[model samples]
Structures are given as C-alpha cells and as structure tokens.
Target: MVSFLSCATQTHSLKPRAIITSALPYANGEIHLGHVASTYLPADVTTRFLKMNGVEAYYVCASDDFGTPILIQAEKEKKTPQEYVAHWNKRDYDDFTAFDICFDFFYRTSSPENIQFVRYVFEKLKQNGHIYETEIIQFYCKNDQKFLPDRYVVGVCPYCKAVDQYSDLCEKCGRVPEEIENPKCAICGQPPTKEKTTHYFFRLKNFGDQLTKWLEENEHLQKDVKKYVQNWISSGLIDWDITRDITWGVPIPGDESKVFYGWFDNHLAYISTVMKFLGDKGIDGREFWNSADIYHFIGKDIVYHHYLFLPAMRLGINQEYKLPDYIPTRGHLTLQSKKISKSRNWYIGLRDFLSHYPADYLRYYLVSINPYSQDDLNFDWDDFATRINSELIANVGNLVNRALGFTKKTFGTIPEPDDLDEKDKDAEMKIKTLLSEMTPLMEQNHLDRALKKVMEFSIYFNQYFQHKEPWKKGPGTNSCVYLSVNAVHAIALALSPFLPQSAQKIWVQLGMPGKTTDHPWSAISEIAIQPGHVLGEIAPIFVRVEDADIKARKEELGTK
Candidate 1:
C-alpha cells in the first residue's frame, strides 16, 4: 500500500493533512439540536474549511453502538442490540445528512473492523503489562437480574456531589468519579447490593506523568480544559476498568461472558474506521494517521474520556496510533435558556428542525454564536429567528439579492468598471483584508469569530451598496455594480464552510460552475467575476423567518 510519507514526497510539497473526528453519537437516541451545537457542526465546519484551503482532511465518525444505554433501549423495544443500533445508525446518518453535517465515513463501533481493532489493542496492552485483572465489588441489580454497569447505576457524583449523575461521568461537573455515592439501580430505582466480580483494568494511572507532559506541550488544546484535566491528574489518576459484564459489547478475548467496556472500544473506532476507509483505497491508514494532525472534536460532557482514557490507551500500546493533536471541546446547548431534556420533550431533533427550516439557517446560527470554549450556548427560539431574519436574511440575503438581482435587471450581465475612485478602491480592499484576518481565525479554531467576521463582511458590503446607490444609474454606477457582484462572490466563498447550502445557492445565482467549495478560499481576495459575465436567474436566496413560525415552535415545546 502507498504510504502517506511516500505520497507526500512524490508531490514535492507536503500538503497539510488532518484526521478530524467528532464524538460518536450514541446509538440509543435521535440526535437533537443540543448534540449538533457542541460537536458535529464545529467538526464539519473545520473539515470543510481545511479542504477549501487545499488541505487533505478526512472527517470520520461512528455510532457509539456498544453502551449499556443501547442495550437497555434495545431490550425495551423488544429488539436485539444489533437490530436496534442498526436502525438508529441509519436514522442518525439521515438526520446528519439533512443538516449538512458531512461526515466522510459514518461507521459503527460494532463493525467487524472496530471489533478486531479493539481486541488487537487489548492484547497489545495486556502484553505490555498495562492491563491487569482484579475482583471488585460491583452493584448487582437483583430486581433486573444483572450487574449494574455505567448507565444501569446512578447516584451523586463523589467528586462534585451532583445528584442524578451517571456512574461513569458527571454531566454537571464533567468529571469521572472512581466511585459514585448513594448508588442505586437505574433499572429498578432501588439501591443495589454489592457483589464481587472479576474485571480487567487498564493502567491509566501509570500514564499520569506522560499525560501531564502531553497536555502541557499541546498548545492547540483549550487552556481552560487543560487546567481542570491537570488538576484531575494532580489529585491522582485511577486505573480504568476496561471490561464489563455485558453481552452487547466487544467480546473479551477467550472470555465469552464478559466484554470490553464501551468507552474502551468506541474511541478506538477512530483509528479502525480510518483504516477501513483508506485500506479500501490501497493506502496505509496507520502511517497516514500517525503522520497527520489528529483532531478529536467533542462536547464538555465527555471531557474525561477523550482527554485521559483515549490517550492513555494509545500510550499503553506504545503509541501505535499517535495521540490527538487537538481536542476542541465546546459546551452544551440549552434550549430557550433551559437544559434540553428529551424526556421532558424540550429538545428539537435534527429531523424535526429540518422540517421547519433550511439546514443552513441552523448551521449559520450555531456557528455564529458558539465560541471556541467550554461555555454553554443557549438556543432560544426568539434569538434563533432574530438572527436568521435580521442577520442572515436581512444582511447577507439582502446583499446577494440586491447585488445580483439588480445586476440581472439593469445590466443582465456584469458591467465593466470605469477608473477607480476612493470609495471603489476602499470596498475592494476590505475583501482582501478580511480574507487575511479570517485565515488565522479559522486556522486557530475560532469558528464563531470567523463566522462573525463573515457577517461583518456582509454588513460592510450592504452598507457600501446602500451608500453607492447603484439604482441611481450615475457615473459610478457601473463600478458599484462591478465591485458589489464581486463582493457577492467573496461572500459566497466565505460562507461556503459556514452556510454551505446558502453558499451553494449564491454560487448558482452567480452562474458559477460547480459548488462554492470547489474553489480555493484564496479566490475571495481576487476580482474573479469578469465584465459581461451572464448572471443566472435572479432570486432571493433566503426567506425571512416569520415570528409566527417561532411562536408555533415555542408552543410545541409548551413554552408560552
């Protein structure tokens, strides 16, 4: 198979390569807007931006198919775990595709490739003395007739004292406790009795010094996140119990009664899925993965697993796959300033949202508001409509429609400009300057800022068009139309990564060949649309989000 290094050498210049991943969505549930806000949307935007900038980037994610939650839901539905996960996997992908979250390969953690890799990694860790077996007191759900692992047990977090926290991780504090306080069987809602069970544990505590060093050195990691993670290390790391008494997970090697923990196998899908994709193309997946910049985009909830467990596993296996270079974690999305709870019917599913509005509207609003931090974002319906109506439809949509619609009506084609005046020169310079400023913002993962900068570009052109009044048909009218049309072109390019569907519509109206992403991002700096270029059929790219529509959505959520 062709290796990445050899391929880079043959090209005479190595292109920037990246393997981007979002946290695997659980197979147990429908993906809600809350899920998209923090992880998938950001990862998709970053991957699209990198590709637009001529980087070789692949976005891979999988269904987290092997958790107790999946088994519980499957049993409730009277279906096998595989059958249940299969249904949600397809459903999740459909929802993601509708929202334009472009994952290159959306596989499953239960896939044969992943199962094999999980076993392989387990064997390697065992041989390297990073794994050991020990008997521990586990909660036995006698009423449910099973050992309560992970989601099957619930209690207050030992570290943060948050009630109703999962045994594995605390949602309120984002920390994993060695043991939860006041544990009860989630299935029976009764306190569970302790029973001795033999389980395998990974030497996660052994990698404390190494993990600390890596976290310190990796400048791309979020400082706020690192501060807490380092504190977790300083307090002392605990050995991770990697095996569970579950039948739905990856079967332990030569042990049919037990399986590898869900967290143990799920993140390994990141490597296995890449291998599956590239191996089909006759490429060395391992070499490519190790050589490229690895990014694991996640939400604040799973911080403990991705930050510690993921890297520790790779380290135990002698770094066969390199550690993540960047783990861009963002905070949760609240609905109308309240925590979105599915059981409460306060969550908007991706499919449900798409039925109400275009995908780009959601994409644009989320990226515009979500900063590159662990700060929680609220998806207020009023705020959503206001941004879409005032900013997206009014500022950006107005600019494109006026520029192209006016050009189509008056000129029917781009008009050649006369000698440049101070106003005309100043307008052109802003596009170039914004492109320069935006490069670093996107590169550094400040996507919210990058999108806001794009909006600022649109606002400037809107004001410039209003000031120039190309409708007056005066001396500078041709120059105004020329620069305005070109500005629309630049706007389309800038919006490609953020609002792809709208950007594509803008491209179609501009009579540009292929998709907006088909062009290099740098083309935004150029006056590419030549004089006399025939414009496509003129139309407004977006409709104003009506207030009545937002009110109806609020009513559905039982909000006044």
Candidate 2:
C-alpha cells in the first residue's frame, strides 16, 4: 500500500540522476527464471521506468568471466579458459538482447580494462592494510600434490557413518569436518594431512560497526532486507577470504603467484562496468564514482557480500566512495515449488521459456509475482499461464484491443468527445495519480507493486470502457469516445516502460505522431493522441500461447 501523497509532484521530485548495477551473471551457464525474477527483471523494469521519468540513469552489468568455475568449465570442454569464456560471452549477450534488457554497458571481466581496474582496487586494498596473506592447515594428498577443497574429497561421516561425506561437511550427520575426529580421503582412502598455504583475506569484520550504523539510518530499505542485514551484523562479520586457489582470475597485480579472489573481484565488476562505459568521458570517473546515489539489485543469498564486502572495497579504496544508496534484493525463484538446481537440471532456461512465450509476457509474470524482500517465489507453470492470460491478455490487452477496434471500425479515425461526465473525469484523475505514484517505486526497485500499478491502469481503462459504453454513442457526439482515446494515451505511455514493444504497437495503432520513444513523460497524465486522428492498420500485439507449444518445449528440455 503506497501512500497517495507519495505520488510524484513537481515540488517533490525524484533525484535528477543515478547509477544502478544488477549483479553480473556468472558466465557459467544460461540464465534461468530464477535469475530473471531475482535480479534481471527488477533491474530492467527499474531502468525502463527511470528512462520514462526523464531521469539520467545508467544500468551496468558484465559477465563474471574469471574464477575457478571458468577453469573447471574450460577443462570439461577441452578448451582454453579464454576460449570457453569467449563463446559464452556471446551467448549471454544474445540472451540479454532477447530479453530486451537495455543495459548501457554489457562488459566482460576478461576485458583488459576490467583486469587493470580490478587489479588497481586490489592493490589499493592491499596497500591500505585491508587485505592480508594468511593460511591454515588444509587437506592434501601427496599422490596428486594438490590442495583438496572439501568437495573434491569425501569420507564416511563418523557420527552417522554415512559413506562419502564431502570433506568439509557431512550431509547425513549435518556436521562440519572440524567436528569429525578422524577422516579419510574418499578419493584414495588415504589419511589426510594438514598443509598450510597463505592467501589474501578482506577485513570485513573491521567494518562491522560502520555497516551497522549505516543500516540503522537507511530506513527506505525494506523491513525484511533490514532484518537480514541486521542478522549478519549482529553475529559480527568475518574477514572474508578474498583469495582463491585458482589460475584464471585477474592475477594478483604484483603477486603473479596469487590471483585476485573471486569474492573480491566479482563485486568490483559493478564499478568496472561503469568505468568501461564512461570510457574517458573526462567527468572524472571518481567525481561521478563517489556519488552517494548507487542502487544495487541482487538476490538474497548474496546480500552481505554485496552490502558489506562491496561497500568495504569502496571504503577501503577511498573513504569517500559512496556506499550503496539503496539495495533492493529479492528472494529466490523456485521451479515447481523446489529450488532451481542447476545440478538437478530443474531450472527454466530463459531462451527456452521465451521460445514458447514472448519476453514481455515472461517479464510481466516474473514482475507480477516477484518476492522483492521475502523468501523464494514459486514459478509454477499453471500460475504463470493464468497470470499472463488473465491479467495481461484478458484485462490489459482486451482493453487496448477493444477500444482501438471500436474506434477504427465505427469512425475509421479517433473522434474527440464533445462532453465529459463525472466518471470520465474521475478515471482520468485516477490514472494521473497512478502514473505519478509509480515512478518513485520503480526508481526504488519496488517493481512488483509498481507493475501491479501499471496493470491497474489497464484495469481502470477497462472499467471505464464498460461503464461509458462508448460503442453505444455516435462517433462525433459521444463524450466517452474522446475520453476513451485520452485514456488509451495514458495507458500506452505508462505501459511503455513495462512492455516497450507492445506499447509502441499501441502508440502506432492509435495513429499518434512521432515515435513512441519520443513521447514525453508528461504525456502519461496529459493526452498526446489528438482527436480525429487516422490510425494505422490494427496489429495483434500479443498472440495467445498454446499448451501444446509449451509442452513440446518442456519435453525438449526434459522438464516435467
């Protein structure tokens, strides 16, 4: 429930400018419904709304191209790590384009600029004494002469005696290896020995008090998000291990033997992407860089990493580099009421999903049922079909098609209504209020409700159509006719952000002059389509998706 006064007004304006970052997709796999619902969809909607509201905003994202996964993937594919990332980077770009996510910059961490910038940040952190080399006794097998991460080695759980417990934790007994009295390497059944190695660690614990103070003061953050952050702060932060035992990452600048840690490097992609876009804009990347208004959209799992480690990196570099002004995080997206597991092969691929349904429909569905700050949201196909078919096709689509169809068939052009009644005025004012109210929420990444607000505009328009009965009156004399035309103008403009292509279709079909993108922000409340306008040929904006089509696609993917 958004307050009425929270609606936009000339006096209470949104910030004139801002920068936003959606967590970079790790370049390991194709994006899934979970990725869309958790981060991309929200970020896309927010960026669109910002552009519509005439705000100077830029969205930045890149592929996380470096890390152990890249190396592991390269080995699996029998390709060089560089070759592997190069192939997937193009795939990711194609996926993003298909989804219509208008990121100003889509960069890759493998870029020379990114590596240089990442190393610079790492160097500064090291110089500031925020990072240090340390080591602990870790399991190693002499036969391989390699350090074994918990996943590589497995052994029987001492307590439950369940065989093949992962080296770090026993799934059956629910105890970590530290709790096990004796363990054998599951690989060779050889006794494990502790060997020490030094690595870089981020002083996350050092900034605990400052992070606590910052969270307490930022009240716009959702209650659930605040609670999550509070829990992390309450337990006290751990100095995050920022170095890894990998070779593919940005090599630690001076220490070629070590590489920039994944946690340390991945989050820096946000800033790195921005610099890549700035590309010597001469505005002093630092000037815009340290600005206080930074928004980060991410999933709940990575909250502390983004909120704490990200800001800490900035703080460790320049105390003045602004902390994230807003962090709008979402819970996970589940498939069939289960967590989307890449290992289990139970995730919804974006490309596969789009093959059956249009991107707007998928975008609309994800936004409609988004869990902005709570737990995971379920993406049941039945729920998906019902929402898009009912809300989108039935309600919003029906309103536009009916109004445009009636206007064209009856008059062959839009006819201005001579007289207006109370209902018409009320509906127009309500639309004004709705459009005004939604801008801020979209800017703040409250996209779930913001989209609902967008849908309600169509709801009201449909309600007005039914009440006014525009079909009953003669073209020139009907007051509802003009009112309906004006109503469609508002609807089209407001819907533009959510469904740009569909909105453009509505705009063109209405015979509005100029491009839909040229439509001003003011047109949402003030009608831009004039009376007595000759519209172009009517086009079907969205085709109904069929069960057979979806089923066939599901079968191809081996989804139940």
Candidate 3:
C-alpha cells in the first residue's frame, strides 16, 4: 500500500503534498453566487491559504459535460450538447477568473484524453471481476420510448401509497418503486411496463470493510457527515449500476450495447482533465494523478457519492490512484434570505456584480461572513453594502488611505512611527497579540474569525492614528515617522490574503516594490516599508457604496 504521507520535503515540515479540487461545475448553465459559495470561493481560499503557508498544492477542477441532463437541456434549447457546454464553459470560466479564483487546471470532461483514461479504469475493474452484468426490471414508458431513470419516473407510492410518487423510488415510503405493487407514469398517466435490460454493476459491497476502516481512522470528517455515510454503509452498499442506456457518455470499452453510467464516468473526470492539461503541456501527468494528496471541496449533497463509491472504485483499481485527503463540505448559500432558484430569477450574475463592486470586496464579504462549519449564509444587497461601507471602506480602507495620505501630504513621503509612549505601547502590544492569534485561526480554517481580526486590527490602527494625530502633531521626527510606516506595512501584509488586490494597491502606494504576493506571511510583523520612501498618490482603497447603487443592483437581481 502506498502511504499517503510518504512524501516529505526537508524545508516543509508538514506531512503529505496536496492537490485540491473544487466540485466540478456542471456544464449546464451560468453559475450563481450559491455555486461560488459552495465550491469555488471556499476552495480557492483553502488553496490560497495552503500555498501561502508553504504547502505544495495544486488546484484542479473541470466541467461535468457528460450526462443525460446536459443532453436533455440541449434538446430543449435546440442546440448540440457540445455547443451548450462550450457556451456555458466559457461563461463559467470568465466568471471564476473575474472573481480571482486561481485554479491550476480548468478541465473538461469531453476531451478525448479523458475518454481514454476513463476507459482504462473501466477495463481494470472488469479484469478484476469487480464489474458484473445484470438484468433488472426497470420502468419504461412506451410512449416516450425511453427508460426512466430513478428521478424521471413518477407514480403512486407503495408504502405510504401516496399518489404521484416517483416511479423509480417512492419518497413517501423511502423505498425503491420496483417494490411498489402498481404504478403509472406521472408524465403521461399511462401504466408503465417493467422491462429487463442488461447492465453493469460496480462491486460496491466488496469494499465495505475497507471503507469502514478508512472512516474510522480519518476522524477529521464532521460528526454529522460521518454519521450519514456510516448509516448508508451499514445498511449496505449494493452493487451500483455502472452502465446506462444512453448515447451521451463514454461507451463501455468493448461493448457497443452500453455506455458507462454518467455519474460514475464523471468522477474520473478530475484525473482525466489533469492528464489532458499535462498532456497538452508535453509533460507526463501520471505522477500527480496516480498519487498526490488530493482534497475534494464539495457541498454536503454529494458527500455519499464522493466518500464511499468514488474512493472505493479507485482502491479497487489496485494502483497508486490517490484518494481524497479531505472533503471540506460547505452548506448552501441563500440570496436575500431565500433560496436562489432559476424559476424565481433570483440568482445574481457575476459579470453584473463585478461591474459595480470590486472583486476583492466580494471575496472579503464572502470569506468574512461564511458559514464555514455549517448552516446557510444569507446574501443581501443591504448587508453587502453595509459591510463594504462600514468595514472595508470605513475601517480597513479608511485607515490605510488616511495614514498614507498624511505621510504623503505632511512629509512628502511615507513615514514610519517612532517607539511607542505608554498608551501607544499598549496599542502596539494589542495589535501584535491579534496577529499572533490570527495565524492559528487561519490555519484551522476559521476564516470568519480571521476576517474579524482584520477588522479589529483596522479599528485598532484607526484609534492609534487618531490618538497620535500625526497630521496635527506635524511629521513626528525621523524615528516616529519610521515607526508609523512600519505599523502600516504590517497591517497591509495581514490583509493581503482576503483583500489581495487592495492590499497590492497599498503595497505599491507605500513605495514597496516587487510582487506583494511573494512575501512570506510570517514576515508580516517585520514592517518592511522604509522611512524617507517617496509614496505614491493615496487613491481610495475602497469606495463607499451609495444607497442608489445598492438599490439598482438589488432591483436588477430581483429581475434576474
């Protein structure tokens, strides 16, 4: 067995190298804030933090372009699935980039390379006898001439005997609809016939023991998530259907009669996409795909599929395919305190939002108020405006602008503050303590609190500035000026991760050169901004949102 923690570097003390993946965005439609909250933004923060902390991390994601859903959507729109995916893929990529998501590889499921890789795994499982052909009776609507998937069929429930329950499964009884005595197609109200068809099933029950052991050792999974999965495994992991009667997915290796199940095939997409990118770059990508510390970022809804069957498939392959290191699941995002639904047109577009607010502002607000552990976070225009105006603009933005503005105006340069007097000494101590606490908080993924610390430090600096009254007291000698510059530099370093663009703005304005991002986080306290440095013009770090601007966006979102 390949130990996950075997790789170690002399300089890096941490065990294991990591490859992070956000849940692949479906190649169906435009992504909304809910999509960003669930996978993109949170995953980006994790990757950014890890890279900032000196971890060797690669972020991978792709478009889930294959599936009946995509086909169905394409038929409705009178366009080919390729055409559909192409349009949305471009749109989604643009949105993610605009939001500053740093994905190492934005992959697609439709690539021929992905097809080859997926087929290779299928052959491996078949050779191992982990796949079996089975004929099962499933509902078929003759009028539509299409076999109804679990979700597509609907009829009267058998257990509770509720009317119009799903034909494949009854939600009321929570039992398979094949057990239902009598059923009718909800779409046509026609009695459906049970037909036998040949299909393949994954040997999920074979890995029950292995899965149980994996869960037992990895106690980092949240209690609720673990319990839900454990309950499913305890009930039994039946041989999952691995072949679908569809033309939309990867065809079964040598079997012209079947195609690999869309869901099962999609899971292999992450690795395949990586291969495609690496193959394009003329590099062998197998080194990373077969073995790397891969972390999957997903929502709770897909936990079961990812945790059990997905890894089980890999482990069954009897190779060095990497298992997910961590699954950082997040809850849903609500817009205007209500669920964002397409029918209601409540979803806000990223392009529209970016037109008015800066990317950093959105990143700052999302990270600051994220329900990281659990629970839904609400996004209201009023709250967004307030947080930006009061916190970013009034506190973080105001303090940076004022300090630099004062230095530029009074001294014709950025000044560092001198050694603190009694009161000043106490404030400096408090700021240092806050920084000390923030490092670990960020390490633990307590981003909300880390953001709060940023705000707290901002408030502290404001109070310190007001008390010192550098503008009124005249340029505080050379030492005093040096001390002030040092303080501002430390604050800029702290805010870099959350407000990277704005932090870079301050980084340049303070007359500091080089890429702001290359600086080590640990050096935040060193205060590198030198005294006697000629400062650039102090532009508005963050502009206050007016009520009219907020109202216009709110109305636009309402009609979206």
Error of 1 at 140 (Å): 0.5
Give per-model TM-scores.
0.96, 0.88, 0.88
Q: Candidate 1: where are CA atoms >4 Å away? A: 1-15, 558-560
- Candidate 3's C-alpha runs over 4 A off are 1-16, 154-193, 279-284, 289-291, 426-436, 474-484
Model-by-model lDDT, in order?
A: 0.89, 0.72, 0.73
Over the stretch 1-560, how does candidate 2's per-residue lDDT look in tens digits?
A: 11011122221445655687888888888988788787877877766666555656678788889865578778989999888988888888789779877777788888888888888887788889888877766677776566655455676775567776764456543333433445556446777777887777778788877777877887767777677667766866667666555677888766787677666777777877777677555555655766626788888767657767787778788764577877888887878787677877888788877776778888888888885675678887767777877888888778778887887888887666665568767876875676667767765667778778877777877887887776667433355666666677777777776777788888888888665556555567775556677877776677776677656655654343
Ranking by TM-score: 1, 2, 3
**Per-residue lDDT tens digits of candidate 3, residues 1-560?**
01112122212333334577888888988777888877788777766656655665667778888766787889999999889998888888888888888778787878787788888898899889898888888778898787765445666675567876654445443343334456666456677887988888889889988888788777556666777677777977667887777677788877866677766877788778766766776866777665555678887656767888788998889755767766777777789988787767888877777878899988888888785565668888899989989888998778777777777777897555565577666655654575566777765557788878878877877877776676556543444455555666777777776667888898888877764556666656564566567877788877788999988887787674
Kindly list the per-residue Cα lDDT of model 1 for residues 259-374, writing each as its tens digit.
Answer: 99989999999999999988987989999999988999999989999999999999999999999999999998998899889888889888888999999999988998899999
Worst 10-residue stretch by lDDT in candidate 1?
2-11
Q: How many angstroms is residue 312 displaced in model 2 relative to the true structure, after the best TM-score fit? A: 1.6
True-structure lDDT of candidate 2: 0.72
Better of 1 and 2 by lDDT: 1
Q: Which residue pairs in model 1 clash with each other?
A: none
